[model samples]
Structure formats: structure tokens, C-alpha cells
Target: MKEGIHPNYREVCFVDLSNGFKFVTRSCANTKEMIEMEDGRKLPLFKLDTSSESHPFYTGTQKSVDTMGGRVEKFRNRFARSVK
Candidate 1:
């Protein structure tokens, strides 16, 4: 990789808005916001609507689609008259 052609990869803070969970990691993502850390250091802050902390899959709050009571039944009912 060329020296000047590469983006600056540095430590940034990612904050989960829903749960207020924060962690520092290296990233090349651009951010215009800054957040002060515990040690009185400021870093680029990236805010996320949903992360692993509040995500349905990770939190085990995922809901299954009830096709049997929804579109599937409606589709069958609509087409059943045409088939018969």
C-alpha cells in the first residue's frame, strides 16, 4: 500500500445510542463528532442506532413472522376461488 494513499486508521469510539454502550477500536471511518474519554482525551465519536447490545438477534428478542395467520392465508384465500 502507498503511504499517502491509505486512509488514517486510528482508535475511535463507537457509541450505541439505544443502550449507551461504548467501546474503543481502530477504524478508518470518518466522523465529525468528538467525545471525551475517561482519561480526559477526545476521540472521534460514531453514534449507532442499533448495535449488538440492542439488536434483536443478539438480545434474543427477535420475532418470527406469522405467515400462517398473515399473507399466506390471504394469498391462499384469494387464489382458492380462482382455482376452484
Candidate 2:
């Protein structure tokens, strides 16, 4: 609650570069871009390579680890020590 000691926290517009999805939330991130919302209010814009909207895990495009040609089993076998 002290003046001039805390970072400026305000509503920021986050854009998913992969999907062009935009959302507004409060943050203290530093950005040089700005975007005007539908309400005619300008907010700081932050660009992201991947967000929940475009991420493989969130979009259900992620590949199963177990189905990756048994790489996990190969690794375990490669380093596994035999017990005498």
C-alpha cells in the first residue's frame, strides 16, 4: 500500500500468437505494445508463443508419452544394472 514502492499493476491484454486469442487480466508485466478493447479502453499488450488456447496439451493435440515408440523403456533398459 506504499506509494512508489510497488510495480504498476493493471489490466493487461494477452495475445496468443499461435491462435490470435486475446484475454485481459491484471498483471505487472512490462510491455511496449497496446491494444484497444471493445469498450474503447486501451491496455498494455503482451504477446505469447503459446497459451492455454493454443497449447498442445490444452488443445488436445498432445501426443501420449507411452506411445512414443517405447523410448522410456529403452532408456530404462540402457542404464538398468543387473543385480547379482
lDDT against the true structure, each candidate:
0.93, 0.91
Name the lDDT of candidate 1.
Answer: 0.93
1-84 in candidate 2: lDDT tens per residue? 788999879999999998899999999999999999999999999999999999999899998868645887778777788633
lDDT string for model 1 (1-84, tens) is 567987789999999999999999999999999999999989999999999999999999999877467887888988997885
Question: 53 in model 1: Cα distance from truth in Å?
Answer: 0.7
lDDT for position 31 in model 2: 96
Off by over 4 Å in 1: 67-74, 77-82
Measured with C-alpha atoms, the lDDT of residue 3 in candidate 2 is 84
Clashes in model 1: which pairs? none
- Show the colliding residue pairs in model 2: none
Error of 1 at 3 (Å): 2.2
| Model 2 deviation from native, Cα RMSD in Å | 4.1
